[model samples]
Target: MPATTIHLVRHGEVFNPNHVLYERLPDFHLSSRGVRMAQATARYIAAHSGLNHAAAVYSSPLDRTRETAGEILKALNSVREERGEQPLELTTDERVIEAGNEFRGKRIGHGDGALWRPENLRLIRNLHKPSWGESYDHIGQRMSDFVYEKVGEYPGEQVIVVSHESPIYSFRHLMETGSAEHWMWKRHTALASVTSFTFDSETRELLAVAYADPAAGVQ
Candidate 1:
């Protein structure tokens, strides 16, 4: 049996005191509240019989995602320990990394080097095929590639992947619809949310897509 399910989890809120778009830059870890959110989501997954049994855990190479994955590993490893199974290690993959953006450190409000400046306006004209940086299609394809490869590696098993909002949602949009293009503002991937995809073990066909925000109540 090939990997049947992959849970794509969005990382918790980041510690961006400056409120600038971090976008692939380094040093953006989770906040204290973000850690709590990640813990809540991790507990939810750990208590779930299926998710707790995940054979592998992966994450985007970014700090926030790795931190979120770390929380999940703690909970899952505790379950594995009780079951006398070896703990799972975290694997960082670049495919699920945050979507690149030109406005890496730009603020959103009306001030110096804001994202809405006239010069930057040209880059944001289209959200679907966004001219800013990485296109949705590319993100979707990379995520798709990572998914199918993992599916092949772990047959009849479950896997967890922690990533940022855009990559998760873009991949979900690509899976749910034929196209990855979507209204950017309409994305439903919340912090510490999980979007699970089930695939036919033998045929590699998509079986179902499910979503859950275990940390929805977290502020």
Candidate 2:
């Protein structure tokens, strides 16, 4: 049984100049620092993993993720071509989207008096009830489905999933370690970092999960 090794990447920093909750905002490109972060992540992946064996790449449909995936491919392509190898292309998957934060489009606080307000978080925690948006449970179900399905299909291969915080966090929570209401607490995913999971082929279950950050353990 071959190992289903997947490279799950979070998208790079968005161009949130105001730094507001730019949820699902279309056309948000990578920040300058974000580009560098993507490059760093790509370099790390290239150095650590095998490009030729990577059968496919999967990413969120969002532009930020698409851009990030491109950089990873570029890194692999550069290193591989240096040694005379062809580059890999990425596939877009809707499964690994940003988890639906209930307070997606709404302002965190009044425009001038803006900050990470306590009330805003309260709103996000109870989002499943209809006043807000999708619940963490709802998001988790989708992520679990994606993880199982993707791994099943690409057994013994390497894949990349680039997506936003919510969906990816749901995946982490499902695969790494987290509860249903964990997102309610204060946890923010840094942009363009890589999160990976290695699954046991015989059981098709996750053997190990890891993140790039050394200081931060699983959220």
Candidate 3:
């Protein structure tokens, strides 16, 4: 493994923060516990092995990523200060956001009249349109491209990426060539989970995947 270790950290829990569906809600923020958990993960990253060579930090454009990356940059900045170096600044890009779910911002309930209900099922029936929401294929490709581009451009320089679960997991799928349609986040990635990839600094190929939590882990 080379020094270009990419850390893919899923944002902390944002679902039902106020007991309401936060899908695509711009105002959604990390829960108090989520914030603390994110800070803890930041500390963990600061102590992690390749971060000393970190050259950049990128995040999804969503507020969740913005917040998570902010916490991480602060921690990494502290590391920079300790090492007598300049601070690490955080940058955001949209390519790392969660695969857009058609139902974003819309209410879903098992009740009779809700969109997920049989009567209004058509509201989410079209899964392939951006108008309906981004298709899984589209999201998967975008995420893969983003990862490939990152490592290809900055070989040997560690970079921390703050992203959503869908994109993060999808990148792994790209490697395994698995059926990415599966919504396996519950079984694979957990809220605030940190996943990592070590790429060959020269070829940009994956050499390993590391997990922060054994059970809620990405393979």
lDDT of 1 by residue, 17-55 (tens): 878888998999999989999999999999999999998
Off by over 4 Å in 2: 50-52, 82-85, 112-131, 176-180, 184-188, 214-219
For 1-219, candidate 2 gives per-residue lDDT tens digits of: 677867677877677765566566678888877777788777777777453356677788888889988988887777778877677778887777765544555554566435456665555434333235666667777777887787888878777777776666666775656554453444445566666778875588788776774212212
Residue 101 lDDT (model 3): 56
lDDT of each: 0.92, 0.69, 0.71
Q: Extract clashing residue pairs from model 1.
A: 1-155, 1-156, 2-155, 2-156, 3-154, 3-155
Alpha-carbon RMSD, each predicted model:
1.1, 4.3, 4.0
* TM-score between candidate 3 and the true structure: 0.83
Say which prediction, candidate 2 or candidate 3, comes out ahead on TM-score: 3
Poorest stretch of ten by lDDT in candidate 3:
123-132
lDDT of 2 at 37: 78
Off by over 4 Å in 1: 1-3
